[model samples]
Target: MANETKKSQKILIVGGGTAGWMAANLFAVHWPDMEICLLESSDIGIIGVGEGSTPHLKFFFDEVGIEESEWMPRCNATYKNGISFVDWSAIPGFNHYFHPFPAQTDDIFTVPAFFSSINARMQGHNANAHPDHYFLETYITAKHCGPIPTENFPFGVAYGYHFDSGLLGQYLAEKAISRGVKRVIGTVTEVILNPRGELASVRLDDDSFLAADFFVDCSGFKSLLLQGALKTRYTSFKENLFNNAAVVMPTPMYGIIPPETKSTALSHGWAWKIPLTTRYGNGYVYSADYITPEQAEMELRQHLGLLESDVTARHLQMKVGRVEKHWEKNCVAVGLAQGFIEPLEATALALSFNTLSAFIKCYEKGGYSNQFEDAFNNEINARFDGVRDYIVCHYKVNQRRDTPYWKDNAANTHVSETLAQIIHFWHRGGDFAKNLYMNNLVGSYQPKSWACLLAGYGVFPPLRSDEHNAPAPSLPDMVQLGDFIRRCGLNFSAHNQLLDHIHRRPA
Candidate 1:
C-alpha cells in the first residue's frame, strides 16, 4: 500500500457536529496543504441543551487561532470556573462541595494542606479535608468571580465555558468553511471500502461518491465509518456505570449568574444546571433500568420547579463506553462515534479535541500511514477507561444510601482493578498521588481531582477519642485559610462584569 503525501491527501469527515467542524479546522491549520471536506445532513438534529466544556476547549480555540472574544459571545457562552456539586452526599457538612480545576497556586499552599488533611484524617485524627475549602478556584467560584487572574496575580487559573452546543457547532462550521475547508451538506447513505478493507469513500443519498485518503467518523452514535463500516468492537460499561439516559429542559435565567455549573443529586440520578447568557441548561441523567423516561422527565421538571410549566422535555439515551480501537485502518472515530464516558465532567468536547490532536500528531508522524495507530489506540483507550473510572468513583463512594440506584452503585462489584486499588490505597493512607504516578494511572484527571472527589464526599473513618490521650494533628487554620482565599479573590472580577465585557464585543 502506498501512502499519499500531505499535498496529495484529501480527508473526508463524515458528519457535522462540533466534532466534524473541529476536525476540519484542525486539519486546515495543521496540514495546510491537505484538502479537508466535511459532509453533514440537514435531516440530523443536534441536542440544544446548553453544554459545558473543560479547560481544553479554550486551548482548542487557541490552537485554531480563534480567540475567546470572537467565539464566546456568539455562542451565548459564559465563563465557568468549575463545577459546584450539591446534595450528592448526606453527611452533615458534606452535602455541598465545589470541584475546581487545579490552579498553579495550589502547589504553593492549597494542595499540600489538602493532602496533609486527608492523611491526618486517615490516621484517625479529625482534620478538615473538605476539597471546597482548599481550592482558590472554589473561592473564586463562590465569590462569583471570573477566572481571569489579574496581570500581577502571578498564578494561573484554569477555566472552561458554558455554551449552547448547537450554536457552537454552527460557529465552528462557519469558521472552518471560511478557511477553505469544503462543507457538503448531504446524507451518507452507503460506505465503500477499498480492497485493503479500509474506507475508500462514502456514497451519499444523491447517488454520488466522495473519496478521500482518510476518513473521520463524527457521525454520532450511528458511527457510519468506524464501527458501522470498519466493524470496530464496542465495549460497554453498563455494569459499573448505569446511567444511560438524559432529559434536558431549558429555563429562563435569573439574577447573578454564577460562574459554575451546578450538579445536584436526585432520586434515581443527578440533575445538571448549566448557566448560559440566554438560558439555563437543565437536565436529569439517570439509568432507565431503575426509572422510566417519563419518570426521569418528571423528576427533572419537578427538580427544576417546572412541573407546571409548558416547556417540553427532550429525552436522550447515552451509550456509556468506548471502542476497543479508536483508530482502525485509515478511519478514526471522533465524538460520539468514538466513545462516551458520560458527560458528568463536561468532557465531551475536550475528549474529542484531545483525541483529534493526538491523531493528527501520530498520523502526521507516520507519514499519513497507519504506522502509529496502535499506539494512538492504546493511549486513547487508557484515557477513556481512566475517565470512566473517575466518573464511576463518584457513584462508588457516594455518601447516600437512601435509593437503590445509589446503593447499588455503592455496592457494585464490577469496578476495574485499578479503581479498586486506588480506593483501597486512599483508605490505607498511602500517598494517593504517588500511587497514581507510580502506576501511570493518571490520565486526564489529576491526583488532586481524585482527592477532591473522595474528600468532597466526606469519605473518612470515625474520629478516635484520642485513644487514651494522643497528640492532635496540626491542621491548617480555617480562619487563616479563609482570609488567604479572600485576599487571593481580589485579583478577579465579578462573573457578570467579565461576561458583559466579553459579550459586548461583536463577533
Candidate 2:
C-alpha cells in the first residue's frame, strides 16, 4: 500500500456564469500558483436573473480586491437595504412590511425593547403604532435612505447590492483571468471518469481532453459533472416549496430606484421587483401545479400594468432541491448546479459564496478526508434545508385566503419538523435570542429575520394568562428613537443620490 497524499494543484471549472467565474476567481486569489482553468461555451446563455444579494457579498469583493467603485457602476449596481414584502398577509389594506438589515446602532438591546414595545401595543396596552417606530434600522429604510457607511458608524449600515448578473460574471472573469486563471471557450461534450470512479478529465467539444486533480461543477442546473458523472442523487423540496417556474422581464424605471427589493405577494406565488440604475428587474415565481407559465406571465403583466403583447417574457424552470452530496468524489457543485430555491430573499449569491468558502476551508486542511467530507456535507445540507424552511415560513404564515394558491399554502404546505419545532418554541415565547444563537440554522436569515416575517404576517402564539406584558416605550423614549433615526438618516444619503455618487466617482 502506498502511504502518500495527493494535493490538488490542477483544477478545472466547468461552466462560466456567476458561479463559475466566482469559483475561478476565489480559487485563483487564494491559490495563485495553482493552475486554474475555466471552460465555458459562448453559445450557452446564463440564467442571469439572480441580481440581488446579501451583505456577505461584501466579503467576497474585499477578498478578491474588487472595490465597490470599480464594480458598482460597471454592473449597474445599486445598494440594497433589505426586502419589503407587500400584501403577504390576509389582512386587507395592509400595505407592506420590511425585513431591514439587522439594526446597526449603539443600542444593541434596542431590538428586544422594540419587540416588547410592539408586543405590548399589539396587546392593546397602547395606541397602535407600526413596528418600525421603535427600530432605527427599519425606520431608516422607511425613510428611503441608503445604508451608507459613516466614520463613526462604520458597521452601522447593513447592505448588499442589486447588479446585472451577466455583467458581474464578466467583471469577475476579467479579475480571475488577471489573477492567472486560464479561460477556455469550449463546451464540455463529455465527462470522463477514472477507473476508481472519480472525475479524471473532461472532453471539450474541440476533441481535447483536459485532466485535473479536482473539478467544480458550475454547469448550472445541468449538474453535468457531479450528477451526470458521479451519479449523485437529488432530494427535492417540491412538497414544501411550490414555486418551480419563474417568468422574468425587464421594465423601464419609472422613478427613483429604491434601496430595498420589493416582493409583492400575488394570487399564485409572488412577484419580485429589483431596481437597477437603468431598469427594474421583474419576475413572477409560481408553481406549475397551480398555474401554467402562460397564466403566470399574464398575471405578471397585469401586475406591471403591461398588455399581454407588450412584454416578451422569459420563462425559467427551477429545480427546487439540492444534490444529495455537494462534495462527491473529487467534484463539488456550486450555484444552481448544487440546488436552487426561489429567489424569495436574494440568497443565490450568498449560497454560492458560502459553499465555495466552505470547500476552500476543507481543501486547506489536508484535502479530501472522510472526516472533512462528512463535516462539509453536513454543514452544506443544513444550510440548504434551513434556507428552504425559511422560505417556506413566508408562505405558511400568510393570512391570505383569496386564491387557491394562498389557501393551499396556508392549509396544506409541507412543514419540516425542524421548522415546526422552531415555530413551536417561538410561539411559546421561548428564548428567541438564545435559539437563534444556538441553532444558527442558516447563514442569511437569523432570529431577527424570522421575527420580521412571523410578526409581519400577524402570526403569533397565544399569550399565556400569567404573561406580564410590559408597557410600551414611553413617549419620550419614542421621541428619542425618532430623533436618533432622523440623525442617522441625515448621515445616509438618498438611494438615488448614492448611485449617482458612485457613478460619478473616479474608478
Candidate 3:
C-alpha cells in the first residue's frame, strides 16, 4: 500500500448545524484538494440556543482567515473574556469569582503568586487566595471591558465569543461554500454499511444513495452513521454528572454588557446567563430525576423575574458521554453524534476542532490508513474524561447543602482515581503541581486551571487559631496586585463600545 499512488479523499458530512459547518470548513482549510461535501438535513434544527467557546475558537477563526468583524456582527456575537461563577461557594467573600482564559502576562508573575497563595491558605496560613484579583481578565471583566488590549498595552489576552448558534451555523455555511465545499440538503433515512462494518453510503428519503471515500457523522445525537450504522458502544458519564435537561429563555438586553458568561449556582443545577447584542440568553441546567421540566422552567422564569411574563422556554435533553471510539472504522463522529459532556465549560466547538485536527494529523500520518485509529480514540476519550473531571470537581467542591443533588454529588465516590489523587494532594499543600505533572495526572487542564477552579470555590481547610492571626508577609499583597490589575485595565475599551465598534464596521 505504501507504493500505491495517492488519491484525493472524498468526505461526506451528514448534518448542517454549527458542528457540521465547522467540520466542513476545517476540512476545506486543511485539505484544499480533498472533495468535501456537507450533506445536511433541513428538518433538523440547531441544538443550543446561544453558544460560548474556549480560546481555541479564536485560533480556529484565525486559521480559517475569518476576522472578528466578518462574523461577530452577523451572529449577534460578543466578546467573552471568561466565565464568572457566582454563588457556587457559600463562603463569604468567596461567593463569586471570574475564571479568566489564559493570558500572555499571566505566567510572568501572577500565576506563581496565585498558586503560592493557594498553597499558603491550604497550609493554615492567613492568605488571600480568591481568584478574582489574581488574573488581569478578572479586572477587565469586573469593569465591563473587552478583552482586546489597547495599543499601549504590551501583553495579550486570550478570549472567546458568545454568539447565536443558529446564525453562526449559517455564517459558517456560507463561508464553507465560498471555499469550495459543496452543500447537499437531504434527510438521511438509512445508512448503508459494507460487510466490513464500515460506512459505504447513506440512503436519503428520496431513495437516493450518496457514497464517499470517508464519512463524518454530524447528525446530532442520533449518530446516524457512526453509532447507528457501526453500532459503536456509547459511554454515559451519569455516574458523576446528573444534570440531564436544560430549559432556555431569552431576557431583554440593556445597560452595560459584560464581556463574559455568567454561571450562577441553582438548586438543582446551575443557571447560565449569556449576553448577545440582540438579547440575553438564559438557561437552567437541572436533573430531571430531581425536578420536572415544568418546574425547572418555572424556576428559571422566577430567576429571571419573568414569572408573570408569557415568555416561552425550550427544553432540551442532554445525553452526556462519548462513544467507545470516535473513529471506529472509515467513519468518524463529530459534535452531538460523537458524544457530549454537557456545556459546563462551553467546549463543544473546541472539542470538535480538536478532534478533526487530531484525526487529520493521525490519519495523514498513517497515509489515511487505520494505523493510528486506536491512538486517536484513546487521546480524545482521555480529553473528554479530563474535562469531565474538571466539571465534576465544581459540583464536588461546591459549598451548597440545600439540595440532595448537591449533597449526593459531594458524597458520591464515583470519581476517577486520578481526580481523587489530585484532591488528596491538594489539601496537604505540598508540591501538588509538580506531582500532577510528574505523575501524568494533568490531562487537558494545567495546574493553574485546577488551582483556579478549586481555589475559586474556597477549597482550603478552615483557618486555625494561630493561622487566623498569621503575619501579613506570608499573604499575597492584594493592595499592590489590585493596583497593577486596575492600572492595566485602563487600556481595554468598554465591552459595549467594543461590540458597537464591530457592529458599526462594514461586514
Candidate 4:
C-alpha cells in the first residue's frame, strides 16, 4: 500500500440532454486529458419543449469556451433581460415590474436619488414617471431585440436566454466532442456497483459494460445512475412549491419579438411565455391536486388569449427539489436527475451549470475527495433551498385572494428564514447584497431581492422612509438621473445590430 500509484480518473456521463452534455462538455474543457465518455440512448427522446434559461447562461458559455456567435444562432436563442411579471399584484392594467440583473452601482450617487424618486412616485406624483426608463433592459429590448453593450456594463447585466433545449443539448455535445469527450450511444439497462456503495460501471442494453472512476447522472427524471443505483432520497418540496405538473407548447413567434419572459399567475399556479427568436415556448406550471391537465391547458390558452385547439400541449409532472445529497458515493446527479423546482425564475439550467462548476472545483481541488464532495453537495442543496424560498415568496407576497389557489397559499404558506430576513430588511428600506451565500451564493448577487415587491404587490407603506435617516435627496440630483437616462443615447436596436454583426463576422 506504500506509495500506491493513483487510479486514472475517468468520468462516465449518463444521458445526453442539456444537463448531461453540459456536464460532459465542462468536464472535457476542464480536463482534456481525462477520460470522459457520455452515454445517450438513440431511442430516447428529450422533452425539449420546457426550455428556457436564466442569465447565468453567459457563465455556461464562457466556462465551456463557446463564443456567442457560434452558439447564439445555433441555439436560436433570444436575449431576455429579465422576467416581466404581470398581474401578480392583483391590480388590473398596472402590475408590471422588473427584476433587472445586478447593475454595477454608483451607490453613492444613484441609491439616494433612486430612493427619493421612488418615494415621490409612490406618493401619487409622477416624479420622472418612468423609473425603468433609466434602466437598460426596457429600452434595449425595445430597440430591435438588442442587448446592452457589454463594455458599458463591465460586471455583466442580468440576462437569460430562451433557446430550443434539444438544440442546446446538441450544440453542447458538439462542443464536448471538439474538446475530446468520448461518446457512447445506448440505453443503460443495468448498473454495476462495488460493495463500497459506489457505482463501479454501467451496463448498456447491448451487453457492454463501461467502467469509470467517477460518474455523473444526467439521465433526466429516471435518474438511472444517481437515484436508481445509489438509492438517493429526493426531498419533497410540494408544501412550499405546490406546483407539480406542466403542460408545455412551442408555438411560432406571431409578431414583434418580446424582449422579456412573461409569467402570469392563474387560479391553479402560473404559466410562462418564453419568446425565442423562432417561437414562443409556453407552459403552464401548476399543481395537479389543484387542477387537472385539461383545466391547466384551458387556463394557459385563456391566458395567452387563445382557444383550446389553438395550441397543442404536452403534459409533464415532477416533484419539487432533489436528492438530499446531489453527490453520494462515486456518482453525482445533474439536471433533472438532481432535482427540479418548476422552472420559476429559470433556475434549472443555472443549477445544472452550478452542479458542474461544483464538480469541477472538487475535481481540481482534491481529486474528488469526500471532503470536496460533501462541501459540493452542501452548497448545491443550499442554492436550491434558497431558490425554493424565493419562489414561495412570490406566492406569499401576492395580494390575490379571489381564487381558492391564491387564498390557500396566502393563508397556509411558510416563508424561508433567509427570505424572511431579506423581507424584514427590505421593509426597512435596505438594499439586498449580491453576496448572500445561503448555501453557496446562487448568483454573485441576489438579483431577485432587488425587485420592489412593494410596487409589484401594491404594498405601499405608510411612509417611504421615516424621518432622521439619510437626508432626503435634494430635488436637483433626482432630476439629473432622469435627464441622464433620457439623454444617455443608449440605443437598444444598435446593441441588437452589434450582436448580429458579431455573428456575421468571419470566425
Candidate 5:
C-alpha cells in the first residue's frame, strides 16, 4: 500500500457553468495541494437556464462542504421533492400524477400496489381508486411550500433544489478560489497536444499557454476540449431517443409556485415549469423536425400564460449519447461536453455530479490509472444508458396520439434494444423484482428507476396483488388521497415572498 511519490498533478478545466464550477470545486476540495486551475471564456455564455435538479445534489453539497444556507440564498435555491406530470398521455380524462424521490417504509414496499390501484382507476376497473394518497408528492404540491416532511427516515427524506445555475457557478468559483484553485479568465484559442496522443496544454486568447497533467471538459455543447482537441468521435443517440430541440425561457411566477417541477406534455413536445426561489424556469422540448423553435416557444408562452421577453426564448439542440471513451490519454469530459438526454426529468446536473465523482474516486485511489479509467467509463455508460432506457420508456408507455408530433414520433420512434425488452417485459406483467444487468442499473443499489420512469409514465403491474401477498383492501379515493397529501405538508410561497427571502439572505 505504498504511495507512489504522488505527482503534484495540474488539472485544467474548460468552460464555466454548473458543470465547470462543480468540477473545479470538487477538485479543489479533495486535492487542495494539486494545481487545479479553471479556464473560462468571459465572452462565451453558458446555458445556465437549467434551474431544476435531482435530490442527489444534497450529496454533492456534502462532498464540496457547501452549507445550504450560504449557497442557497445566493443561488435562488428552492427545495424540490419530485416532479409532477400532466397530459403526458394526452388522454381526455383527468390523468395527472407525480414521481416522488426515494421513499421507503420499514413495514412494507407498497409501490406496486400504489401504481396498480391508480392504473385500475384509470382503466375504470375500480370504482374507488385511491392509489397515491399516502405519497409525499401529492401532499407537497398541494401545500406549495417545501418544509422537510417528518417522515420515518431520520437522516432526512430525499430532496433536490431549484436554483439559479449562473449564481451557482459564481458561488462555486469563489469557493474554489478560496480553496487555492487558480481561475484563468480567457477563451481557449488553441489546444496543444503531445506526440503520445495526449493533450499537453491549451492556449488562451491572451496568447498564454496553460499546461496541465489532466484536462476536464465542461464546454457545454461545443465539447471544445475532449471532442474538438482530443477528436473523440461522438456517438449518436438520435435513433434511440427522440425530441432534440428545446426552447427555454425564465419567466415570473403566475401564482403560488409548487415545490415540484411540472412537465406537461403538449401537442408537439413537452413543457417544463421549474420554480426557483425567485422566478419560474419554463421550456418546451420538441422535435425541431416536427415543430419550429418559434412555434415551440409560442406554445411554452401559452402554457405559462405569458409573452416573450429578453430572457423569454433560448433554443438548445442535443443528441442523446456520450463519447465512446470519456477518458482517453489524459483528458476527461464532464457535463454537456460528455452528453445530454433531453430533460424529461431533471437529471442533467445529477449526471454531471456522478461523472465527476467517478473521476475523483479514480484519481484519489491512484492518479490516472487505467483501472480507474475503465471503471469510470463503465459507470458513466451505465448511468447514461439506464437514463436513456427510462426516458425512452416515457415515450413508449404514453397513450397520447393527439398531434402528428406525438403520434408519428411515438409510433415511429426506434426504441433501443433495452427499452424494447423492458416494454415487452412490462406488457407481459413483469415485476421490477428481477435484476437489471444493463450498464446503467439505476444508481448503486437504489430503485430510482422504478420510482421515476415506471411510476411517472404510469406503467403498472398487471396484477394489483403482486405488491403484497395478502388480499388487497379497498384504497381511498383520488380526491381524498389528494386531500390527505395536502394535510401532511409540502407547500410553496408566493413569488414575491420567495424572491424577498432570496434577496435578504447572504451567500
Candidate 6:
C-alpha cells in the first residue's frame, strides 16, 4: 500500500495587497515552475498606513530582484536609519532617545558596560555624554541626511525604507505578473472546505470556483480561508497592547525629510511620523477606552499643528491580535490575516514576509508533514509572542503620570513571564546577550533594542562589582568617537540630494 498524502502544486493566494503580492513574487521567484495564482477584489480598499519598515525588507527586495531605483521613485520612498522616540518617559528633556540599527564596530561593549560608561560620563557633567555618541548611525542620520547607500555598512550604518504601502503592493504585483504569476480580480463570496477540515477552494462573486492544492490567506483581517473556512480562533493581545484604534493622515513635508521615523508619545498613545519623498505618513494610535475616534482626530490635528479642515483623517479600528495558528492543514494566513499589533515598530510587513519565507522553506524540505506543521506553528507563535512582549516593554517601563491612559498603562500593563524574567535578569546586572527571550532567530527588536527602552525609562540594573569598578572609556576615546561621527555626517551627501541622484540615473 502506498501513502495517500497530498502534495501542494497549484497555490491559490487570496488577497491582493502587499502581503499577497509579496507571497506571489517570492513563490514565483524561488519556484518558477510552480503555478501561483493571486486573487484580489477591485472593490476592496487596502489599509495602506504601514509606511515604515525594518531592515529585513531589504532582504525581501533583493530576493525578488527589486531595485531601489525601480521602487523608490515609484513609491515616493525615503531612506530610514532607525526610529527616534520622544517623550516616552516623563523626564522632560531627558526623555528623547534613538533606537538605532546595530553599530558597525568590533569594539561594541556589552549593555552593562555601555550603560556604565554613559553613567560615569554623565556624572562628570559632560554635555556630550549621551547614548547617541556611542552609535555611528546617529551621525549618519544627523549629517548624511539618511542611511548609507551600501547594504553592507562597514561604518555600522543599517537602514530600511519608509514608502507608500499601496504603491509597494502595486509594484510587487507588476513584478510578480512579469514573473508569470496569474492574477484574478474578484471578491470571494464563499470558502469551501473539505471533509478533513482543509481548504478545498474559494468561490468568487461570479459564482465560479477556484481550486488549488494549497491556499494562502492574505485576505487582510478577515482571515477568509484560515479563520473563515478552517475556523481558527484568534488570540487577542488587547490586554497586553491597549491601543485598539488609529486615525491616519498625510501632511505635506514642512522641511527636509529626516532619515529616521519619529514616534512621539501622546497622552493616550503615540503618533508616528514617517517622512516620504513628497508627504509625511502620520497616524495617532490610541486606546478607544481612553478616547474616541473623533477625539483622536482632534488630538492628532492639534499634534500636527493643523486645523480640522487642514487634512482629512481616516479612522481605523485596529485588531490587536494573531490567529490561534498561522498555518492549519493546507491553509496558511499571512499579513493582517495572520495578526496585527499596531504600527509601533512597523512589524506588519516584516511579519508577513517571515511567514511566507518560512512556509516555503518548510514545504520544500519536509513536504508539510504533521511534524513540520507543528514546527511551523511553534516558530510563528514564538515570533508573534516575542513581538508582543517587546511592544509591551515600551509601555511597561514608562514613568509618565500626565494622563489617565499613561497612568493606567504605567500601573496596569501586563507583562508576560518571559518578559518578566528578562527584566528580572536585567535588574540583577545580567548580560542581555545571554537572554534567549531578548533575542530570536527571526525578528527585528533585539536585545539592543530592549536596552534602549530600558535605558530610556531609567531602568538600569544594579552595577556588578566588576562593572562598577571597571575603567570607563577615556575622555580622549570619547572625543575621537564624536569626531568620527561629525566627520561621517559632514562627508555624506544630504538625503534629498541622494534621492535626486538616484532619480536622475537611468533605470
Candidate that would win on TM-score: 1
Question: Which of candidates 2 and 6 is the stronger one according to TM-score?
Answer: 2
lDDT of each: 0.88, 0.80, 0.87, 0.71, 0.71, 0.78
Q: Each model's TM-score, in the order given?
A: 0.98, 0.92, 0.97, 0.87, 0.86, 0.90
Candidate 3 lDDT score at position 460: 86
Q: Candidate 4: where is the Cα deviation over 4 Å?
A: 1-7, 92-94, 105-112, 115-134, 142-145, 150-156, 308-310, 428-450, 463-478, 489-491, 494-507
Which 10-residue window of candidate 6 scores lowest in summed lDDT?
Answer: 121-130
Instruction: Report the Cα RMSD per candidate.
Output: 1.3, 3.0, 1.7, 3.9, 4.5, 3.7
Clashing pairs in 6: 104-156
lDDT of 2 by residue, 388-453 (tens): 889998888788999898888888638988788667656665456566577754354666777777
Q: In model 2, which residue pairs have backbone atoms overlapping below 3 Å?
A: none
Pick the winner on lDDT between candidates 4 and 6. Answer: 6
Candidate 6 on 282-392: residue-level lDDT in tens? Answer: 999999999989899998999998875667899999999999899888888999999998788888888888888888887766744434777887888888888888888
Stretch of 10 with least lDDT, candidate 1: 42-51
Any runs in candidate 5 off by more than 4 Å, and if so which?
1-7, 92-94, 106-109, 115-131, 150-155, 307-312, 434-507
Question: At residue 151, what lDDT does model 5 achieve?
Answer: 52
Q: Tens digits of per-residue lDDT for model 1 on 1-507?
A: 366688988899988988888899998989888889999998886545439988999999999999888999889999998988888999999999889987898888888788888888878887888898888999988888999978989889899999988999999999988888999988989999989899999998899999998899999888889989999999999998999999998999978888999999999889999999999999999999999999999889889889899998889999888889989988999999998887889888888998999999998888888889999999888888888999999999999999899999999999999899889888988577887888877777888999998889888888887744867666787788888888889999999999898899776
Comparing candidate 1 with candidate 2, which one achieves the higher lDDT?
Answer: 1
Clashing pairs in 5: 130-476, 139-485, 140-490, 143-491, 144-491, 144-492, 145-491, 145-492, 382-439, 382-440
Backbone clash tally for model 6? 1
The pairs that clash in candidate 1 are none
Over 4 Å off, model 2: 1-8, 106-109, 118-130, 367-371, 435-444, 461-476
Report the error of model 5 at residue 450, Å. 3.3
